[model samples]
Target: MKFITLSNGVKMPILGYGTFTMSNDETERCVTEAIQVGYRLIDTAQAYRNEEGVGNAIVKCGVSREELFITTKIWVENAGYEKAKRSLEESLKKLQTEYIDLVLIHQAFNDYYGTWKALEEAYKSGKVRAIGVSNFYPDRFMDLVTFSEINPMINQLETHVFQQHKNDKKFLEKYGTKLEAWAPFARGSHGIFENEVLMQIAKQHNKTIGQVALRFLIQNGIIAIPKSVHKNRMEENLNIFDFSLSNENIKKIEELDLGENVFMDHENAEDIERFFKMFKIGNK
Candidate 1:
């Protein structure tokens, strides 16, 4: 398991187990299995509503708290300083941890600056070891980095073979902020699994297209979290350490870049409206 040291000097795994849409029972079971299969970093979010399940897995996994790197997000509904802080406290209760390894402002919506301030305070209080943002496009990413007392240590993006996020990587490099990919597979869309370039590379190394895809990101110094409900896929995702992709093949995979998002777009008006509605309901 390779690690990348954030600007703040904390080491984060280059790969992690993502628990985005897992149910309570699924989060608990898959997280347990992930740990047993040697995954130390578990990603969850308050919006996922499975923090309790993740917490349950942490308690029951029989792994010491220190060995695990737990990350969660402050949902859009929990924006603002007080709401964000209180929500993290609730997350702590749900996650069964005294301190989270990383806590990200889940979206750029609402009072994220204020939400970031809460994260900053939490960092000072030793309640969180690292702070970051997710789905923060370049404009918002730079805005937060410029005004914050402590720079964001990570920015999780919608990255995959098609949306390589090259420009974002260069921008993050300027601030010493790290990059993490949320959907490293493009969710199997855009013919990612069936691509000729990727297929050829996978054949050369006797690896699956998924493994080749993950190796490409990890090699490019990007941290990625690929979620899977199956134990076999979980293990396969973890098995990319032994082989290295050639620069020639890396260049081939780079050709797959389309510079577009495969999933939700933050700039979409409907998406923005959805965020507002989701939070408005939460306030009630």
Candidate 2:
């Protein structure tokens, strides 16, 4: 697997496995298959309620803890310094790890500065090797990075072929934060699977549309975590390193960008309201 060095000098895998909607049982099964397929980076979150499943898989995967790069996010309910710090410890216990390879605030809302402080403390104390934020658009990202003691090593975003986040990438580059893509396949939204351009590219490269999509993200220096429950799909996603995309191919994919998000938008008022309501209801 290839890696990108973060601003703080930690190397992160260019590709990973995401446990977004998986239950504890499903996470364990899929993560086990994923690890067997040679995935070293495994991303989970407090909201996912499957950290224990990931932990189970970790113990059974026959790989040393040091060989895996485990990541989990702080949920909205765990938003302040005391809460976030306490949550991190709980995550450590559920993940069955003495230390986390990386940790991030799950969203831009809910006292993220306080959450970041907790992450910074974890980093300083060696409980976490790297720290970052997820779903933070440029404005909030800038605010946090500008005032925070430690700049985020990464900013995970809803990036895909349709929602390319090109400008965001350039903006984050200025601050030395790497852009990581969740839903790199657009979760099959925006007709991403059936898109003619991706299909044609896949045919040319003798790869699947999913492979081409993931390749596009990684080629542009974005870290991709493509989730799948099937072992075959897991293996296919991990097999993109053998071939490279040509410049012409890259341009065609670039033109497919719509410059809009296919999923939730952080800047939208309704979306922001939904987030507030959802987290207020409760968090796992």
Question: Which candidate gets the maximum lDDT versus the true structure?
Answer: 2
Q: lDDT (CA) for every model shown?
A: 0.92, 0.92
Best by TM-score: 2
Would you estimate the TM-scores of all the predictions?
Answer: 0.96, 0.97
- Model 2: lDDT equals 0.92
User: Candidate 2 residues 176-263, lDDT tens each?
Assistant: 8899999998898988889999899999989999999999999999999999999999999999998899999999999999888776
TM-score, candidate 1, is: 0.96
119-171: candidate 1 lDDT, tens digit per residue: 99999999999999999998898888889898899999989999999988998
Residue pairs of candidate 2 with colliding backbone atoms? none
User: How much does candidate 2 score in TM-score?
Assistant: 0.97
